[model samples]
Target: MLEKKSEFTIYPITVLQDNIVWVWVHNCNAVVVDPSISEPVEKWLLEKNLSLKAILQTHHHDDHIGGTQKLIKRWPQAKVVASKKELKRIPFQTFSVGDNDVFHLMDSEIKVIEVNGHTNNHIAFYISKEATKYNILFPGDTLFSGGCGRLLEGTPTQMFESLCKLNSLPKSTKIYPAHEYTENNLKWALTLEPTNLSIIERLKLIQNKLQKGMTSLPSTLSEERKTNLFLRAENIDKFTMLRRHKDSWKC
Candidate 1:
């Protein structure tokens, strides 16, 4: 028997206010997730001498799909993968997918998970059983580091169910959420759970990372399970209450 090899490299390109455009590189090909702009991603890919293979869109938000047109013009053959239901919103999609759809990309299997919370047709990509050190999840705006997405289009119950779907994944999954809201979210959590040691310790570590101009995302499932109030909610009602409170709570 031979040992499998890990060949993928995920790069986090922080763009806009809090959005993070994730670039997954394999060999000489690369795939970008939720590009808020084109110049930075185009420049980065050009500098690395990597050709764009695809652009994976998790939702139809302007921030998530803003750079797709420009990026595709630079690499005409590069596939634009987005939600099939978002055709009107994301018109550049060459490969439109739906819930439970599985596709191979960069030598890894990508599973589409429909999570309706921030949006009605939002989806999260999951790559499990990889030879890499950990599994990967590009959860978009659904699940954040210390919190989840705001209930914009979907209801509290919908968001809660969506979170439950994500929480069902393995604890080793490395979450690559779209935004850099971990620090702020954790701060909010601390206010609600001041006595919780896990929240306190996580906040301290996140503060240190911020001080060094670092991102505190890509949180593990285990870490989120322990500290994320949304994920820890026992039922839909509890999740609803927490969401409502967080929505109005100030930092």
Candidate 2:
């Protein structure tokens, strides 16, 4: 039912609990990112009559790549793009890529960024096109709206470095993280910095959007710099401290 008139556009399909499967569409072709399941995505693509061009897997987590095999069954020719370092973990990847690797798809340039934190070999996709107004980042679970992913397979140092790399992107870059954790993240930030006007204001706006059943994502990098505490950390110690606090945080 979604319109397909745009030269390029990204749509979010909220699946499972808070996971968001981002579908990037250009003309009649579609590329799904971190599809948690195949039913809804299959239904949506079938309804729009869009051809599945590929599926971008950020990591090997079940919630991220669970539906990939099923989707590939539906679209036999659709390529599975994933980190080359994760071949053992993500065996379905047909187009294996590594850090700094660049490729063209859907008339846009995609740069692979190896951001290991939530999981070793986790990677993010950065999309840029001369025709688009702004760039896009499909950061999977490594970066969120108001927080960063917990250090699971990698160390604090790795996560800190990963966030710095993302922060270096153009401020206008729109972030499409793989989960709908904006509201909860902002609330947690507010608890830490109660007087932060940026956090308070963004929380109100995000709450309103969620109340209306709208996603509070695809947030610009500039907005994240203003409110994401993890991004504001100046050093590894600070970043580590914030991560520990967030892990133990109840709210």
Candidate 3:
């Protein structure tokens, strides 16, 4: 579904296979999250006549930060918000934040959540309910619609803990992940629980959305609690087993 433009709206720009560049718009200003490339994002902003406000970098991954430098070049005054620990990797950050650090942006309070799993020092941005109708989470690569990020540089235990941190958020929170992997992740979940009606129904709904060229994202925490296996995992052992299975399993 297309997000309605109100006082503030977040829109998705699909690029580079599954990468999603999320743009948060308020008035004539915009904040982009994890831009994989510059051309399309720049064109979109220019066409909309929106002035770039800042860029939220969830991690230092090349795909996430690749377009940042160019975007900042176009909007020279725009701030680059990223983890303080990733200074070496993401040298462009003008606003460095640490875990639990609260900061204000676009008239809303943003809480930094350090969720190291996809990579060490990986972080997620959490906007409290005071910011919007519902709380918002920009999980970058740490969390997806139906799955958690791969254990690229962090341990399975760390990944499990990271997901737990995300899970602790209010059920009404809307999750905006960096990639469009809901359908594939749900399909993988079905293999483990073929009789699970929640996963079954969610997969069908996500498939319909994808068929219509709509992104199956911005999923609510409540919806994920019911369908996402990683979030449902009770312990590190279960999470590790599922993560390993998913890594080796093919569609």
Candidate 4:
């Protein structure tokens, strides 16, 4: 039997109310995703002796980019990657990428996926064929474990299409979203899909994880297929209805 080699290690640092700062480390160099604050991320990297190689911004939201400037100041050579279309919003971006553009970092290939529902220029990073894994999606706020991001700037149609694109990925793909909204999302989902055993079971498991103070994120595409109402949506109309219902739903 061949030993499995770890391609990357992801660190989830909870910041603010629900924002999660994801740090992807490979060979002592790190790439941060949607860092809401700088101090903790800076301290974490320093303690691990890992160099900050780049910052991947999915949107221009303040919580996502507030730490970029400070992190760049600590590691001036670190690349700040963001959507080229949002130059005015994310002006500090050193590497302005567009839809479908492929870039290399930390011995892995990253493909930029434009998902404009949460924000007009929101983008997701997809890493396929990393070490032995088939896929990994850093979907910012576009897609969550059991729910999706609010339609802040884009329309339901845009969000629907963006989610369709994500659902097309391999089932084994691991998702690393920007926030820790799984427990709440799943709770709301269960109310909507009362008869869905998959949703019920998943919610119970996630609730247990939360009680134990463990993260219930980085959910697999397969898991979402069974329990995520957004991913299971069959048509745009269905997606729009679900989005509306969730938007009005409290708790």
- By TM-score, the best candidate is 2
Across 114-217, the per-residue lDDT of candidate 1 in tens digits comes to: 99989989999998754665589999999999999998899998899999999999998999999999888988998888999999999999999989988887
Best by lDDT: 2
TM-score of 1: 0.96
Candidate 4 lDDT over 1-251, as tens digits, reads 11223567787898899888998888778999988889999998898888999999999999999999999999999999999999999999999999999999988899999998998999999988655766889999999999899999999999999999999999999999998899888888888878999988888998899899888888999999999999899999999999999999999
TM-score rank order: 2, 3, 4, 1
- How many clashes in each candidate? 0, 0, 0, 0
What does each candidate score in C-alpha RMSD?
3.3, 0.9, 2.0, 2.9
lDDT of 4 at 10: 81
Winner of 1 and 2 under lDDT: 2
lDDT of 4: 0.91
Q: Between candidates 2 and 4, name the one with more favorable TM-score.
A: 2
By lDDT rank, best first, the candidates go 2, 3, 4, 1
- For candidate 4, the clash count comes to 0
After superposing candidate 4 on the true structure, give the runs of residues whose Cα lies further than 4 Å from its correct spot: 1-6
Q: Between 2 and 4, whose lDDT is larger?
A: 2
TM-score of each: 0.96, 0.98, 0.97, 0.96
Evaluated against the true structure, the overall lDDT of model 1 is 0.90
Task: Flag regions of model 3 displaced more than 4 Å.
Answer: 1-6
Query: Model 1, 172: alpha-carbon shift in Å?
Result: 0.2
**Regions of model 2 farther than 4 Å from truth:** none
